[model samples]
Target: MRILNTIESALSGFLFLLGIVISLYSVFMRYVLGASQSWATEVYTMLLVWAIFIGFSTALKEDKHIAIEFLYDKSGPTMKKVSQVIVFIIGIGFSLFIIWTGFNMVLTAYSQQIKTIDLGFPIWINYLIMPIAGILLFIRFCEKAYKYFVKHEEVTHGGDVEWKQ
Candidate 1:
């Protein structure tokens, strides 16, 4: 899990930097060189999609995903733990569904031999991010679920408790 997290984080960071470089280079090519690079936009778009989906999973694992924690923070220990469990279970199920559907889409595109306009690559190569994201999401949620089931809970002195990842 640790190694996977590190790889995801590094890939996310690299894609982000590479995306920026691509965009800047595209601008320079268009404005300064007076010649447009047709492939730049398509590549940048693909990079953006990959970066967001991949980085999203890492963020979810790190508990950086956004949520309405106000009510959770004000909840009692039992309620807080229960809410977390409910949320994680729902997330796991949703992720599984996404994985199933995404894999189907990838397979369909592959069978159809769909190709990208600029890159002339199989479009499935682009849509492949969907299942990859779903798998990462599933793993992260399962890890959280495991923690919820196996880890000892923190007993609080206050009436309300705040739950962090």
Candidate 2:
């Protein structure tokens, strides 16, 4: 699992850097070189989506996603555990939904011969990220739930987080 997490992180980091570089290059080309690109928009958008989906798994592992902290902060340990369980269940549910719908979407795109407007790339290739990331997120959620419920531990990326401590 740790190895998988590391790989996911590496992919996410690569995508982040590539997306920024491409976006910057696109901007420079548009404003500095005076050559408007027809494909830049589509490329950047796809990069952004891919980065986001890939990053989602690491974000869950790091516990960086948004939560209602006000109530959680004041709650007791039992309440906190309960909340975490609930959140984990919700996350699992959503991830499953994404996996199912994403598979359907890819099939639909493939069957219909859908393509990106600017580059004409097969749309299913882009939609493939959804199910892949969804599975990753679901596994992370299950891991978290196991730690919280079975091991009775608080899994956090930052042991020095002042608020959590």
TM-score of each: 0.89, 0.88
**Global lDDT of model 2:** 0.84
Best by TM-score: 1
**True-structure RMSD, every candidate:** 4.0, 3.0
Tell me the lDDT of model 2 at 120. Answer: 95
The digit string of per-residue lDDT tens for model 1 on 32-91 reads: 999999899988888888999999788777677777678876998789778877888799
Give me candidate 2's TM-score against the actual structure: 0.88
Each prediction's whole-model lDDT (CA)? 0.83, 0.84
Across 91-112, the per-residue lDDT of candidate 2 in tens digits comes to: 9999999999999999999999
Q: Which ten residues in a row have the lowest lDDT in candidate 1?
A: 153-162
